[model samples]
Target: MKIKDFPHAGETPPFGAGGSGVGLYIHIPFCKQACHYCDFHFSTSLKKKNELVDALCQEMILRKDEIPGPLQTIYFGGGTPSLLEAEELAQIFKTIDSHFEVNPDAEITLEANPDDLTEAKLKMLAASRINRLSIGVQSFFEEDLKLMNRAHNAIEAVTCLELAKNYFDNISIDLIYGMPDMSDARWQENLDKTLALDIPHISSYALTVEPNTALQKFIEKGVVKPVDDAVAQGHFEILIERMQQAGFENYEFSNFGKPGYYSQNNTAYWTGKSYLGIGPSAHSYDGETRSWNVNSNPKYIKAIQSGELPIERETLSVTDKYNEYVMTGLRTIWGISLIKIEESFGLKFKEYALQQAQKHIEEHLLFLDQDRIVVTQKGKFLSDGLASDLFLINLS
Candidate 1:
């Protein structure tokens, strides 16, 4: 079962023939402590970390025939990949290298927590194949950190970046805005501090209360103030203005990067490229089909041990694919190509898109930038909502 021998090898037309490349997303779902706002699938215990890692590697071997070509990017996300020991990483890499053809200069990324990235750990990562770091440095203030229940302190946040920059040239930090009671001055300080470190990329998001999370519970109990939408929009505006001023390109909504520093892994996902996601609760896409593993660690491990995949699959309809294209394309600078939409989804779908987008264009929320439909600055903050408005609700 050769990967290249598979028909429709990769998702996009250009993928197998030097177009959009394949990616691997490895979810490590163990965290030292859960953040208040996080609702991602994870556990606070490391009891199954070793077993889970083994299952992940096994799943890769079992699904070796799925991907099309050599991987251009490999992302180690969730449960703090930095928590894994160097030996564990080596074993995982050995399995991957033996099974797949990884590009020599592939963009291998590992999501790290500031507290976990000690000097020793950084040195190990520097020597390893992981070439990029996405550090979780939500805030540089004690009050903000305490509110979010983040494990790393403000000092560790600053120190980690200082040390990380010395080891890795490509570094991205996560920053949260719109926290309860966060002020403009405080938000400015966070940006100022981040800029001071000269980080190459930034992924910023507004703090939102997710159902069943500690933050949601606190908000429900009035223990924490609710997130204000207007305040969040204001913060986002400030972020865009500042980041653009700093010469960073807002390549995608919530993501800003310097030229040549955009995240290859996420970019592939946005551009409809195929990726294989390993581990519990992770998702994989092979163009037409979307599959996800069970979210429970025990179940995921048991199924793999029993030689079962433990994954549920869904084959997307034509309408579903078109909606996804609109949603992702509108949020990106590349925008949606009208000709591609017409050719791929048929002339009627393209006409419907143009008709639905006409109102927003009149409202100054969207406009035709040559052959592509793009969000104007006035519509940037509300791009998701605007994109949704243009979706094909009834494709029958």
Candidate 2:
């Protein structure tokens, strides 16, 4: 199932209407090479790297008052943030410091590819105050890597993890299951490497071929075999069982972590906390309105240089907010809080949610627990579908 296919799920507001504890997301839209499955905005060529960086800093300065005091998390996600030199990272951080009040213990994460995490780079990262690393080790097998057109090979994947663990204890690695050629054994081997690495957190997703992506074309032309939904479901079940056995909490649909190791940045998003997303194609939400920067690099840089925000805005309706609450809340271990629904969206919305969830509860897909609607183990793999099924269609 497509993760982004949830009906009625869009720009969701935070827990309370005016909630303020904020997170900062910096989108570095440059990758060394494009992955077949990736649809996120990015550029393969870094011809305007300096100008883009300057634009990012300017955006931060321009939008400093978007969110209130004490930024709780700072996430650097993108084509490959690890590609940036240490000095560049520091320059961006310096800009953020000048404009925002970053908590001393805030979670600062950099999304890095396996090949870029060299020994010297790790040391520089450790010194740069980036306390966490989210490595894109999509698979531990060479075959899978080649199929996805990843920049790093299987050997580099393993080697980098070994090196990264020494410098940073708070690390998360991403792995993909449900590839066209992935067998049960290969899926197990990927998990085996993950567990062997003693990594505290893991985020895994089923391989989805988005429209216009290479994988989609390959399947259309019969160049590559199509992914099996049943097989993907099986892989997910295996992942849940294995992670539970290893003492990791399935905090969110695709994330498993050892208690405190949960991704604070992502959790903020799932829990509906306000955040300021900077750079190209980045999204930002403050309680009532959600906005996004221009997706094109040249347009975004030009707009920023011209002293315009280069963003689009959407003011969420009350119905829209409640629908979002149902969508994001059900995807996490925290589930949907009935009290929150009643308090934030009103009793009518809460009653509507309960009425809609009745069928799923009877089907054993979802259950009520101390006022929270939670997905049962049997329904975890189908959470997105189930959530959409429970969404309120009326916005009035």
Model 2: per-residue Cα lDDT over 140-227, one tens digit each: 9998999999999999999999999889999999999999879888898899889999999999999998999999999999999998
Identify the leading candidate in terms of lDDT.
1
**C-alpha lDDT (0 to 100) for residue 93 of candidate 1:** 99
Colliding residue pairs in candidate 2: 14-272
Error of 1 at 22 (Å): 0.4
lDDT of each: 0.88, 0.87
- Per-prediction TM-score to the true structure, in the order listed: 0.95, 0.94
Worst 10 residues of 2 by lDDT: 1-10
- Clash number for model 2? 1
Please report how far candidate 1 places residue 370 from its true position, in Å.
Answer: 2.0
Model 1 lDDT tens row, 233-279: 99999999899899887867888988778888768877788899999
lDDT score, candidate 2: 0.87
